[model samples]
Target: MGLKSSQIKQLERLYRRKIAPKSVISSQLVKDLCTAAFELGRIVGLLVNRRGSVENVILGDATRLYLPDIGRIRASSQRLRGLRLIVAKPKKKQRLKAKSNMVFRPSLYEIDHDFIVDLEKLRLDLVLQIQAHVEAESKKASLAIIADKGTKVEYFRDVNNISFDFSQFIAELEAKITSQIKKAHKIALIKGERGAAILIGVYLKTQKAWKYSLNELKELCVAAKVTVVDTEVQRRLKLDAKTVVGQGKLEDICLSALHKGAQTIIFDCDLSPSQLNSITDLTDLKVLDRTMLILDIFAKRAVSRAGKLQVELAQLKYSLPRLAKKQTGLSRLTGGIGGQGPGETKLEVDRRRAKDKVAKIEGEIETLKRQRRLRSSKRHEKKIPTIAIVGYTNAGKSTLLNALTNSKVLAKNELFATLDPTARRLRFPKEHEVILTDTVGFIRDLPKGLINAFRATLEELKDADLLLHVVDATDQQYVKHSKIVEDLLGDLKLLEQKRVIALNKCDLVDSEIAHKKAKMLGGTCISAKSRSGFKDLMAMCSQALWPKDIFR
Candidate 1:
């Protein structure tokens, strides 16, 4: 970063030099560039527009070149940035001396993979790198451009001999890229409206559950209508304080996302506000963490006014900390005359508005809670036993409810398909009826804010005369899934409530295996889709809810 005044002036002069647009660079200019970098013993970079005018000059350490922010151009767009990068790095003599004994002579240098990533991520027209050496014969150069598959790289043995019509080459390259993009677009049209995403996971060295976490994250993305293109994982003793993934890894991910035409990056774990800001600052790709993805799904799936309010409250509370980032020009004095209040900064005003909105939503939810309580009281007066359906998300809870009550409640095979609690009357042959309520499903590491926001809805579980715990028999981690649900119930102080475990989706598993698993968990095997074992499930529920009616 340190440069003498003369060196600074030399770099400033680069902006004044113009070359013919048809040529990549004149041999004399290349010599001058190499000479400057060789003298400075650092990497030098130039951002050149298509018209052959230098826009910016960058300096980096001996090993790498750090380009400045080039503005937010969507990487997935079918266009190229009207710019190219030319970089030159000084070759060290000690390395050459160490390899002097080799029978075959080594070339000066090769292009860095990071630069190729930069080329694709920035959608640059092309990238050229020159290895500057003191001896003219040892100097070499490399050129890279976007190709049909990924990137096409070509090396020049001697920098002086490099010659190409830059304008024609770039025009042809862009044409090919446009054709490829058109083909890709037609394919995507047939695939429905789903955005592409990359999944990222950062875990401590001691953590071995990352695979399951990522698997669930992928499911969450699918539920949110996002198509996952690839995944990245890192193991660290401790996560980076700023970006959860280290800076280098974050850059690599951004580049990979660009390469795959992914529009979003989803982290498997929840991110702190500062971490989110830090990561977003490094790339323009849309960034989301697990909590945000879940909140988005809830916002989409909520069908009732109360459900919508609860989700909005949770999102507002979750984003309250993110608004702490400083905002410019919000601190202007608004009280021109006798207004007695201290003018609030824009940041303070934004936080105040968010807090007020959250309070308003919470108040509305309270009103809904009272309405529910009134209805609950009327049911209490009727002396009907309340049975609430609860289980891990996508575990056939809604399907089971529909199978039992014959009511249409938007049963889908996606996570959080039903957000609002649905109630139906289950009448028995003996004139005994129970209030069956289908509540929202739970997941592992469910956001705490969501839990607190849905308190009014979940409170119904406390009043539940019996809890119908449904388990997905096909899940390999069903035991762990059950434990997560139980732990959440324990947190809500509903663990002591009477419970009946029903292993749903038994038809999908082997009959013997399903029965064995049901026996092991002290539950009944039933297929919510096929009605198999429903009799046994109902018998167990009746025994728990009305022990005296078990003989009936």
Candidate 2:
């Protein structure tokens, strides 16, 4: 890494040299750059803007060079970065073969894959590599530019022979990229949705699990009304410590997202604070994990005051520890009820204020919980059995309640469609009346903050006499879905409670298969949408609630 004063001065002088706007590089400039690299025994690189003025003079070891932080490409813009990179690499005489005419092949100077990564990731105007030789007559260079899907590279036998107008070449390349992006995003524009995202999943588990997780992420994105422009999945032995997905895959994802006009990156797995920080730093894009996306959906779906308070509490608790100095994501949560305090630094102030808000919200939620407890006592006094319907999200629990009571409770075929619990009184065929309650749906790996914040609402489940587990009959992953609900119930210590599994959506599958599935799981088959199995479902519920009583 040692540099002589003469070498340092020569490299510094490069920053003062101006290139011709119409040509890639002048013959004299190329000769001087090659001479500097040959003397320093290292690679010399330059960052040149479209005006043909040198912006930076970079020094690197033989193989790799690191660029300074140039800000991100604006997501709204569909053009190149308007800057190009030129590098001079000195080669040993043994690595270069001597031809009959004493000239080496231009392929020796072909662009490296690392440079290709830079070309796509930075959206550079172009990248040029010169194979610096002691004999100036034998120097060769290669040029690369952005193509439709990847990069296009060309080689020149002589670095000094390039005569094309660099400015005009860059203009046409940007126009092509802009036109393709417009065509690709036309449908999203027509739909008038603003947030466009790319979904990322890194899995070491079974492929089925991976696919299911990614599909669930997609549904979450849909529930949030984000336009999914693309999805990238990596099958790895284990998650990368820093990026979750490896750095290479993440770079490819950024390039794809950049080309597809996506402004956000949504991961299928929950991210630790360090992973989130590392990922956001690498791409400079809005980064969100499964938990953040779920919390956001809860924020949007919450209607009741209690529900809203619970959602805000969950968001704050999840965001407090993750508040970094450079954090730009999760602004909605960090901003809090009152805006930033005057004269207080951001990171420390956000954590302090969020803790205060969490305490206030917790107190409010506890008050609501006490009120709910009083109501539960009244039901207990009347000797009315309570049945709480719980299942994986979008498993038709709300629809089943609507079908049984003929009351609408905002039933939609989306995840977490019913955030606030709804209760209705329904009479069995035997005229035995019971209070049926619908609670928030469950999912695998539910965020811990969500579980703690919604504990008040879920407390009612502990008092219920029977747990009606609704299973989506049509899903190929129904067994796994049932297991997830059971696992959650076990975590809540409600598994010991009497339970009745009703396989909902039976009409969407074959009747024989549905019946077999119900029999296998020791449950009843029913269609919440059609109400076809209402009688059997009621019989099962009545038998579970009043086993000693005889029913007609």
Highest-TM-score candidate:
1
Global Cα RMSD, each model = 3.4, 5.1
Which candidate ranks first by lDDT, i.e. highest?
A: 2
Q: Cα RMSD (Å) between model 1 and the true structure?
A: 3.4
Candidate 1 TM-score versus the reference: 0.89
* Candidate 2 global TM-score: 0.88
Off by over 4 Å in 2: 1-13, 72-77, 95-108, 134-138, 192-194, 325-345, 381-384
lDDT (tens digit, per residue) of candidate 1 on 371-480: 98998999999899899999999999999989999988788888898899999999765577998999999998899999999999999999889999999999998999
Tens-place lDDT digits, model 2, residues 314-427: 999999878875634434333446665433457657678899999999999999999999999999999989999999999999999999999988999899999999999988
The lDDT for every candidate, in the order shown, is 0.85, 0.86
Find the 10 residues in a row with the least total lDDT in model 1: 180-189
User: Could you tell me every candidate's TM-score relative to the true structure?
Assistant: 0.89, 0.88
Structure candidate 1, residue pairs in collision: 330-346
